[model samples]
Target: MGAFGVALILGLNALVGYDLLHQREETLARAREDSAAMALVLEQHATDSLSGVAKILAGVVEVLAVRADAWERGDADVFALLRRQATLSPLIRAILVVSADGKLIHDTQTLEPAGIDLSDRDYLMAHRDRLVPGGANAVFVGNPVRGRTSNTWFISMSRRLEAPDGRFAGVLVAVMEPMAFRSFYQTLPLSGDAVVTLYHADGPVIARFPDHDSHIGLSAHHLPLFTTLLKQARAGTELLDSAGDGPRRILSYRASAEMPLAVTVSSSRDAVLVPWWSKAMTLAVADLAGTLVLAAMTLALLCEAGRRERAMADLQDSERALRDSQQRLIQDIAARHRIEAELIAAKQVSDAANRAKTQFLANMSHELRTPLNAVIGFAEALESGIFGQMSAKQTEYVGDIRKSGQHLLSLINDILDTTKIESGKYVLHQEDLPVDDLIGECLRQMGPLAVEKGVTLTAALPGSLPILHADARAVRQILLNLLSNAVKFTPPGGRIVVEADRVARSLRLRVSDTGIGIPAIELDQVMEPFHQVDNSHTRRYAGTGLGLPLVKSLVELQDGRFVLSSVLGRGTTATVLFPPSRLRNRSEPLRALKRAQPAPV
Candidate 1:
């Protein structure tokens, strides 16, 4: 067939979808009626099971009430008749008749309801309003305890009986086996693959037909069909449509007059879709086969046409390749221009860094002059008594002024030292020094500040550690900056532990603290110049944050690597590892000592 004819047939095929859903809905509706009628039939059996027991058992109660009344009125002949009535029935576990005068007049099955307050019995009390015709039809079945009427707790029914004048005389109460009522569920026809659910009208599953016990006594918790049926005021079947991926189930129900329960039957969407789907699939396969045949014939013509077309395309492609080669040469020239632009950008960055370095040096010079002037001026004032008589506060404040000046001077020197290191103009003063003593010296400078903060300062340098091929002054400065910050951040009672050991050709000095540690993300930023973590509040702690950055640069100057590792809120550990002096000749220790150190007091 041509294209239009095939499309027409396909459109006709699409029209079958409605008939399919209609046939499906109708077929499902028929199935529902059969099932519903079956439900109705089963419902009658259930009613028969309940009502039949009511009639036969009610007759037993009627007979017992008559003889028990005779016994209460002192008629011995009628008492013998009641004995026959009670002992004759086997399903009746027990029988008792209580009189209006609060006396248990008769009993059978070895137990007698005598000398007990029958007036207090639920049967007697419930029957007191029996002047109304037909009395209340609601019945209660309970298990009463054996032997005592007041201590009663066994499964039995209490039904109100009437006198011939419709007077409330007594009650007809029957004690039946607990299993008798449960037999209704057992005798119903439940498909082995299907489930039969008996639930409380309030929607708790009371029982299930088959095992697995899935629904038994469960709060019908939010089953969609169960909820929907409650909203609707009738009994009907719903086949959940699944073509749009909604619920794919079939449900039907019967509301229980016994309780608020609705019994629902659910079937898989696949089960219902099976018949029509097969029919549609057969048509689909025919259409696909026809389509494949058309495609094959069309493909044969297309391939023949493409063969001639490819020859022309090959000739054109050869000509285009030559033109493209020439075009690529011009594009390469443009790419070279981009590379040159990138170089210019890099040169600008280098120039900016150079200008920053110059500004930093000017700042350091100014920083150095202020501290030197203070120390000189404060010492001169103290020696000459320029501020008149000196009290403790006067002497103390001057000492602080001088001390502050020196500390600023020391920081300024570290900045200058880092500048030299970066310029490749810095020299290492390698020495045959006791690495343990150098480590001890660093700890001694840091201990008082640590003690002031209540931080424990300790060291674990091996006594026989090898000498390092490092500038001892640079090492000390680096350790000072690291330990100062460690103790500064460490809260009161925290510990700062300095540990070192020679590993093969390298000596590793590690300064660790129990402090509010560096954030892992921010640790890399700490080595950048002028960086501080929360500098606004750190005014309480001395030193610009340049200390660690300076230490990093100094360590790198001697071909040593400095690494920092920290767990946030716990502590930081800064480690410096350098090659040992044993690896360098004595003559290699060049003169490079510009930073001044205050003598150990």
Candidate 2:
């Protein structure tokens, strides 16, 4: 992190360290005292055993001297050598002697090194006239000097015996390795890192224990403890500080009681520091985790509270809008009722006007028909030459007068039909009539005019045709009018066909003629009252133009329909379609006419 964070962490660790320091005392001195005491106990035991070894070697010399005599007597020395080697005594293992005269003496263990010279050896030279520690007679044990070489590291003591004339004699000696003393000192209770170092006051070491074996002839680590011992030469109790391959160790050390040496007690730092850091980090992580969880829970609660407040405001707005809409709907219903009443009154007035129109048409038709009858009758008789023979010019003028009268008659009839439709008085008396006979009658009436013009007027009636159901008078009038118009317009030597047949559902009545045909634009107009193809053509064809209109009205009255098809100067067909009910009614047998007129002619 940052420098401040580093400093704070160190501060906290120091606080923990300071707390532990106050709880336990620092015991460098007490450790030194205990370790030194234990080392002294082992050293005392080693010194005692060294004294005993000197005494045993003194006896070893006597046994060797006795075994030599046994050899001189030619007796076995084996039993005496066995007694000396049999016991693994804490002091001595073998005993022998060497002479200052440079010759080896025999003993129980001397058979292998016989006749060897010893006067020049260190055992003989160093103790030529000294008294030995074995009560003034100890000899070096296991020493090669004096003809014995078994002692690995030890000193020997010997004394010279003078002749009666005070002459110098050979040395007597003792040998010891000091290994027993070293093993005892190393096994005493001490810290695992402790070291017991033994060195000569001079440069080279005489011997050492604590087999930190590499330090046998070297100085210990150059630590505070070692520096104090070297600089001040103070050998009292003190704390040791050292670093090594094992661990950073704390030590307590003091000089040994009677040896030029020191004993150190040390403990590794791992034994104290590891658990302290573990506890500190455990507490730190637990606190951080608890704080984060609480923060997240608080954020969730605030978000939920905000959502509820917004919902309540929206609900209030919707409730106010609903009440306003209900008030507007009530006012709309009241306005609608008033408009409906006005429409009812207006409908009644329109209906009365239409009835008046029907009445006026019926009355005027009668009036016009009566006067036309007089005019047409008078003009016809005159044209007949009934008032005496007249000039050709007069006959022609009278013919025109008669045609105009008949035309006016046709106009009045159409007006009467329209009035019936307006008044809704049109009725049908449907009955059966033979379709084939019906065509025959229509052709019979129109045949003479066709024959006079030399047009081939004929009926194409199919024998298998059905009876037709319609008002007999109305159906007859429709066909008669169509046939008459066909014959009147057709050119001389042309043809006319009155065809009656059943085609699909309707009974087809087609009146076709080779006539002065209608032009496409004028075809629809001819069906309207007073509308003709053209004025010049109208005067030439001799019709009031109401004939087709009257036929259409009568055909529709029987629930039939009329259609006219024409091509200019070619021909025309007038077809009436009477639906199936009419055809079936015709097939029924008919009784004698209740009311009959002369057959249509």
Candidate 3:
């Protein structure tokens, strides 16, 4: 009886505790919803206020652009017009017209002359330097600054005033007092620890509730909230530690669509849980009283001895189950460890095999080149009669030997270059070289091959081309490889063109061929070394398939970009874009090329 009573009481306690916990969750959820709603209201208010201020500034700019003489002479009519616009919104502190040189020409605040130079002010300078376009119906918001005369903190927004001819004339300024926002936020039912912040797109805190002068002009760009604003989420919620005050809070933020700013409303986490805590305490006390009553009723009337026996059996069964689970977990961990060890050993073996292959290729390159060079040298001597050849058959045989040796050497060189590029040991010699002359040289070298293949090769160059600060040899090689492939794959009656044109921030060289073009699905594979396009049209062409891949690597070494596009049976266009930093003017003097640092192996 006693054991049964104890179990019943314990179960009752657990049920009550769970119910209370569920209620606590529901209360907290409601509070969070309320906070989000209030934040939304605040966000809308801020957006409307700033948007109104921007519209007023736009109107002021229009007026200033038309009546420049009246404003320059400090006309009363202009001052009255500015005063009326400033008084329309309580958020605005002052409206002034400043000249191109940053001298205050007219003011709605006061007529007294105060020596103020705003040329160095960020907002004014931003307009002067053309950082923001003039007369775009857009406003430029500046960081918060303290007024010298009033000693009050203010954030300013301005619009550029342009002349009739679209030249910059001056700026129309509208200063907003942060205190006005603070005063409005004070009416909201927010806790003392709660914080409200407004961030300019450029990272400064433009306004804060429960306003602090020290925080207004500070940059909060490092905060997670600021970064979130940069991503331009319309309205979202997160829990973060406050940037100014270090309280963890549930912050709801919204970004302005019409202005370059964001607003965040944060509430303390502790305050949100206050109602839940109160309800939990009440439920806990009631549960304890009920448990005591129920336990007392069954204390003496329950079956104690039999209940104890069954409880002992259950405890034993639970222990056995726990032991089995632990054993299974241990076996699983051991199997995982073995698999990991095998994977590591396999990776090491694979790496070793790759190293061996590289070493063999390097050795074979030297071995083959040595004999090939000797064979070619001797054949050239016999063909030129330097070895005193007597018969016509000997002359023809010598010619064949020379051509065979040269072909073998070219194949070996291509393999070596591919190896070097793959091993990351490629180097470049960069210099100022005429782009036009480079194109001409490549054409001259490929002229005979083009004629033999019956392909029309031509250069489409602009009248004057910019010189490039690049590796002359690498540039020549890239052109040679591209031209060679074009002439090789193109049909006898096909056309190949080498074109150069200037693009924004880069110089582009395009080699287009009216040959059997590559299929769209196989474009990516064509840039892989030793992989050719798999199609009937490409089967007849003979190549080692390293030309395009080598060209890509060489262009990248010079800090350039390579782009390839092709449509089957239409054409293939290969473009090399060298960055503008590598472009030199036509008059640039020739200088020695700088050797590029060898790529890391």
Candidate 4:
């Protein structure tokens, strides 16, 4: 019977796992189909958008062909025709008329110089050097480029302007802003991590939703997604790492029917599987509960059968032995009952404590924030001299009051955050975030603090680093707290360094300070909430002692590790390590910034 029970349980477990797996696959398949549909829609929209510009360009070409003499005479009506075309198309940034020799004759935006040369432009060069066979009205879509006149990224579309004698006259070009395409993408019902990108066949990204200005004209040659699309058929779907932020995603792309541009739409695996995982977990828990109940029933039946067998043996032998067996069985049963009762009581107590803790934290958060907010607001008003200021002493007093209020507000906010984390009310909004950007911003914000404290600060970030899949706000807070503490403790002439390096399958960020170092014995205690090394009411530093504890909580929430090491008289180094699972390679290029050296206080 026991063997049969074990076999049944194993079979059920396998069946449940297989069903969940199947459901998850089905969900992913649906997401892929959705992404493909979205890609097709985007492609059509892009075609229509470009086709509209092409029509406007075609109109200008015909007008110029019919009125070549008017153009030569600098006819206001001809220039007005060009301006009208640009006005009709809001997406068109500018319209330029370049002579056959590549010299600009007229610009819809300005008429400063008729001799300005645009021969160096790709669209001009393409139109001047080569002609499409048997297609005189063909529109050439140039690569995404920055125009010297506008100094903004645009997609240039040009049509060959012809003379009445059928010879080429000049190139009539219309520059379209990438933001026009981005606006269309924003209207799509895409997940937060879902990305919609429009890129040229060769490499440059024309427009992308969730865009970075720097990536508008950046090269995407290193991306497998683009390279694979270039090799494969015009339209297809595949699982690939996102070329923008390195999350694994299901990407569907379709090349434009008219242009050399491709529209790619991607949905992140995490977003697609979120609802499926929730349902799967629920079913899994239910299955586990049922399995436990079955096992318990099986054990009870087995025990009863053993008890009956013992009774039969005792009855056939002696009464005394039967009585002894009965007493031992009773005692064992009573002990088991007592242990079960204790377990039930302990569980009840734990549940009650948890509820109480959650309630207390919530109440304290609301109550404290309300009054602290008022205090800070009033103090700010006084410091700003909204109420007329009197003497120097009065101004100084107001400044002190404002500073104290601000400090108190900060402490209150930290306490609320820590309480939320401890009570399990804190949630992380995880996404692909550029750690380098966050690091740079943190250093900038902490710069003034570091200088005021007479501490030299430096940062050495790699030219390239993997983007972190984490809560950006939490990660920023962690860095700010660490850097703030470093600045606070380090004395005059002391140096603080913030650097990041890749280790094995993880990334490590270290913040080291030449501060009054912590004692080795208090290292573990320092991470405890509200437990400072100098646990005195009149401590030199102003803090609530929740910085390290809060940092540790935030790091662990993202499945990362935080470690602190210090010597008695030396400095402290705080290291935050993120596992490989939490680190993703970035698809987009980053602007190179120089490594910072220690700045004198």
Candidate 5:
């Protein structure tokens, strides 16, 4: 009986000890996962911010490449452009154009050239000295420094500007404030003693959440993160002691592949182990009570051997319950793993189906266009008497065929364009297009159809309009689609008007028509691809419903806005507003505008 009591005590101690260790490991694993997730979120935020700054610098470089003389001369238009670019994102503190000799030529903050010289700045020096390996165009990210103009700390993302002859002209710098990053970090839902930090590859901390002011601009080279972990991998998690006898922490980090930046999320070891410690204490107390009970049972057994059988049976029952509990835990874990696997598989299948659908639409559209074009060509030939003279009835039938073929072709083209845009394969060919010419071309193409439908078409233009920097074909398509829909829906003798004017900072183009307008509830649905306001089989209008949606997509792709408003049985108006960035300076010279003939009222 004494030997059995001793064995039972040893077994209970082993089981409790094992459970505590397992729980400790599980707590640490969860902490590692949480830190890693937070690190990824922070890393993406840093990447986006840096990428925006880089894009601004690249745009500045491109501008300088073409208008180097104007930029150097502090042209007002160039200054205004710089200011507009700066306002694009809150992350950008300023956009500066530095001369080859390091003189501050101009910045977005002022139109006049500043007397400040930035020759000593690392970003300018790096460009001037050709320190970047990508030659004149490589973007350089410099350490945080106090801005000469703003008198605040900012990090610089700069690119080397080049002359028309490919000579080094100067440096185009975009100033980014660290406070913007810190503000964003503060918004994250972080738990106790967890710190989120942004670091430059050069070892200096750029920003930190929970406000570590002293660490900013300070090198972290002494830490294993810089000395060992960063050298080993671009991303990883580790358990390490914090600096200067601070609490030990589990740190997860990720480095941006496109920029020399890293994000770290760290949680203190004690905070992560809090739940495990509580559980351990409770478990320890329970083990102590059980040990005391077992000791008393041993004493009772020595005096009364009959009680030993009962005690042994109770011990066996407890062991059986523990085994059953462990089996249930294993089964639950397995079920959870299976659920996760199924979810992943479902997502992959959905993505593949979407890709397949897009590809099918693209392929089928192209296939149909080839044969349909031949049919339209032959029909046009017959109508034009290229083959021979035909009877009047035959001529009318050929015209019908030609018209039907053209309509089908248009639908196919819309389908192809929609697929291309959805798949991100469409590229914009932007140029300086006169708004008047774009409107006139679209109006001329759409005029005949409107006239045949007995709908009067007219244009309302301001005295002068700014040149639109956009893809000419896309703008033309947008106008044509709007006008075509107007003509199709308008009753005979109804009027359709095209209007253009400068509204605030945007250029607005509106097409208003006295047509069978859509219901208020269906206006939003009409903007969806292939979604017709009248989708019933007996609908009066004949359309594939791609027109307005295509126009909206094209306008938005150029950073513009599209709005459609209508009232049932009254009228509908389609409005496209191009952003200021897409419009040339109003003061710049433009071609003479031609007034369109007025329609009969």
Candidate 6:
């Protein structure tokens, strides 16, 4: 009986110890998974945000490619463009154009050049000295520096601006503040001592959640993450011991493939082990109680060998206590499983909400367009004197009604078109289209607008050009939107040129206008639906801000690439390149070609 009691005590301790170890491992594994998932989310956010900055820098360079001189001349329109671009992203503190000599040509915050010389800046010197690889379009990210204009900390992203002759023109730069990243990180669902951090590939901390301002811009190159881990892999997870007696941390990191950025998520090991600790404590208490009961029963059995009934009753009581401990242990495990199930269900709900929002947008756009069309038709009839206009004042009022209605209708149409394209409901009606006729008809349609604006509009087409196999109405709309935008933005004496030619087997249609050009930083953003270069409430231009986006969509629907470039205070060029696939071969039978048809909206 004594030996049996000793063995029971030993077996119970071993079993509970093993269970505790297993639970500890399970908790740590869960912590690592959560950290890794968060790291991936942070990495994607950093990549997308930085990629946007790169595109803005490239756009600025492209816009100034033709008229780099305007940047040097301190054009007010150029400054306005810069301001507009800066407003597009809260992360961007300023947009600047620096001449070849490193003098500030224009900055978004000031109407006139700041006259600051940034020749010594590493980012500027890198481009000037041709140290940056990847030609003119490559973006160079610089270490964090205090902004001279805003007196705030910011990192610079810059690209080299080259003239048409391929000479170094200037450096176009966008300054990004880290606060935006920190703000974004705060919105993430992190608990306890968990933290998210954004780091430059060079090892400086760009932003951190929980708002560690002093740590910003500090280098962590000596850390294992940079010295050994990152050197081995672009992404990974590891357990790190803290300095002194602090708890260890489990960190997971991911590096961006598109930019010089990395993100990390770290969770305190103590916090992760909390559930395991509770389970271990309960098990320890149960084991101690069972061991005491077993020892008492063993002693009673030995001392009361003569009293068999009494010894049997004591053993039954010990067995009942052991059964209760086992039941409690099972309940603990069941509770943990229930918590995990709840977490999974919560994630499912979040995903469903996102899908519902997208569907709502599509449905709302359709509902708005139906009544809007009717409003425009009634306004048009009233303007045409069908409602019996009596006086000059009444005529002007009717004209205003029609104009406002048209503008609202245009906005609704753009919204509907965007939704259709996004939902994959937009279809193209392909046909063999005459390049000359398409340009001519579009010009004719836009001639009145150009004349009203007192702007010169002309087309330069080669004597012979291949036919474009595309949706005729889509092509026509693309051309008209480009021309209309040119006319609307161009000054009274400005010139707008429409040129078409063949590059190998592809067709390139370019619309160049001597208008208030777009800021380089806004080039990519302007391609997105309803995004305008000038988005201020009191902006000089009027439209739905959908023309370029619509044109881009239509061009791409036919498998073409659309490129936009502009020079501040000089002009903008919208180029649509149709691939060899979309260019009709002269040898193909025109008789079997489908007639030009309009695509359903």
- Top candidate (lDDT): 5
**Residue-by-residue lDDT tens digits, candidate 3, 1-601:** 6687788889989998888778867866675676667777877787899889988887777666677464443555576679889998998988878878888877888754356887888777888777875444567888888887788788888888777887777788898988787788777788766778777777788778766556788887888866664475777777677756667778887777767777777778777777777767765765665565555456424634455455545546655776897799899999999999999999999999997887677679879999999999999998898868559998998888998898778767777777777788767667787777778878888898899899999989899888798888889889988998889878889999999989754799999999888989888998898889877777877777888988898898887889999888888899999977788777777686432322211
What is the TM-score of each predicted model, taking all chains together?
0.38, 0.36, 0.48, 0.49, 0.54, 0.52
**Candidate 6 overall lDDT versus native:** 0.79
Q: Over all chains combined, what TM-score does candidate 5 have?
A: 0.54
Model 2 — which ten-residue stretch has the worst lDDT? 138-147
Q: Which digits, one per residue and each the tens of the lDDT, describe model 4 over residues 1-601?
A: 7887687778878999999999999999999999999989989988888889999998887777776443552344465567779987768987888888877776777634356567788877776666543367788888888777567788898998767787777788897889988887888789888888888877788999886476788878788756666577888888877646667889898888687788888888888999999888866875685466446545645776665454445434554555687799899999999999999999999999988876786688679878877877887787787888767888788778877876776777788888888777898887777777778888988998788878998888888888788887899899999998998888889999999989755889999998888988989999998888973422778787899999999998887889999976679999998877777777744333323543332
Better candidate by lDDT, 2 or 6: 6
Q: Rank the candidates by TM-score, best first.
A: 5, 6, 4, 3, 1, 2
TM-score winner between 3 and 5, please give it.
5
Worst 10 residues of 6 by lDDT: 592-601
Give lDDT tens digits, candidate 2, residues 302-387: 56656545544554665576578778988798778877877887888788877777798799998889989999999999999888
For model 2, what is the C-alpha lDDT against the true structure? 0.58
**Would you list the C-alpha lDDT of every candidate in the order shown?**
0.62, 0.58, 0.79, 0.80, 0.85, 0.79
**True-structure Cα RMSD, model 1:** 32.4
Q: How should the candidates be ordered by lDDT, best one leading?
A: 5, 4, 6, 3, 1, 2
User: What is the model-wide C-alpha lDDT for candidate 1?
Assistant: 0.62
- Supply candidate 1's per-residue lDDT for 489: 84
Residue 443 C-alpha lDDT in model 6: 81
Evaluated at residue 561, the lDDT of candidate 6 is: 81
Error of 6 at 518 (Å): 37
User: What stretches of model 2 exceed 4 Å from their correct place?
Assistant: 1-358, 374-407, 534-544, 585-587, 592-601
Candidate 6: tens digits of C-alpha lDDT, residues 1-601: 8898788779888988888899899889888998898898889888888888786766666666655445645574566567767777777988888878889888776656666788899888899888887876789988777777677778888988776688887788898888899888888888677878788889888888875587788888887778888889999899987441145889898999888898888888988888788878877876776676666667867777545456457557867887998899899999999999999999999989866765777788778777767877776777687878658887788668777776676666666666677668888887788777778878877787788889988888888778778888788878878887888888899999999998645799999998888888988888887677764521867776778888888888887889999887788999998977677766666533444432211
Q: Compared with the true structure, what per-residue lDDT tens digits does model 1 show for residues 1-601?
A: 3575456546656665566667777766766665566555554544454454456557756564555344454343344455555455444555565565557655554333455565765456656755323555445433222336434223345565556676655655566442342354566554333444544445555445553144444566466545676578546666664331236656566775652345555445565557667766854564454454445434534566565455445546655775897799899999999999999999999999997886688567666777598676876589457878788787787778776776777767766776666666667777555566666677777777777778888887564665465677777888888887887788899988888876544678899888887777888898987777764434466666788888888887776779999888788899987754333433444243332332341
Candidate 4: worst-modelled 10 consecutive residues by lDDT: 592-601
- Against the correct fold, how does model 4 do in TM-score? 0.49
lDDT of 2 at 569: 84
